[model samples]
Target: MSGSFSLFIVGWGIIMIVLLAIGGFFMFRKFLKRLPKEDGKSILDWEEHYLELTRHMWGEDEKQFLEELVSPVPELFRDIARQKIASKIGEVALNKKQKQITRDTIIEGYIIATPKRDHKFLIKTLKEKNIDLRPYQSLFEQA
Candidate 1:
């Protein structure tokens, strides 16, 4: 009976060690992914730069609109999704050297940043808002 109990404890210890190793591996991988690239910019740095570039252009109304646009995302992920979409929109605005954030910029940025699977939600939302999508049809097709 003592030997059986000892074996059970050893087995449990082995399992716990394996689980910890797996967890540690994933944590290390995430750390690597956040490291700066050749451009000397990490993902977080790029996001911050984009946000700063377009900060002056975001009015309360535009903020509200962006929140509404990302409402379809699950509650837990909505904030991250919103940030990514906003960053992308800012990048788009910067690329176009726009003086202000236009509706087209918002839409284009949202479409570009989101995965193809989420395009269906975007299309439905745009339709509900009566926003014409002819301009982005090709982009949607490519996605």
Candidate 2:
């Protein structure tokens, strides 16, 4: 009877261990599936690489164009623009506008078109209304 009881105890221990192992295996797989996969390249990284290639192909004009468009905005605004570009919102409008605005003209236009510092006032008004301008930075940058 003693030997039989010991055999039953050992068998139960073995069964519990197997069940635990199976549960752990499934849990590990589920965890892995739920985790986000990384291709390693981020949107910014891709954009930089693409811009570098464009600069190479199109020469200084393309680089200057990108610099003029991208350099005016604050870093935070630039990041928002990047995300908006990824979303493809009003892409055609921006493409059309880019052709019209020369780099020299943009600086001059901003100075001439906005008087009484109205642009600052408008920004303040928008902020007061809780409007998020970050998303719209790309639209302005293209102008």
Q: Best candidate per lDDT, number?
A: 1
Structural similarity to truth (TM-score) of each candidate: 0.75, 0.27
Return the top candidate by TM-score.
1
Ten residues in sequence with the least summed lDDT for candidate 1: 25-34
TM-score of predicted model 2?
0.27
Off by more than 4 A, model 2: 39-143
lDDT of 1 by residue, 1-143 (tens): 99999999999999999999999997897677579999998886788799988999887878888888999889977987898899999999999999888888899998898899878888999898899999999879876
Put down candidate 2 lDDT per residue, 75-115, tens digits, no spaces: 85565443333222122223444433343332333322233
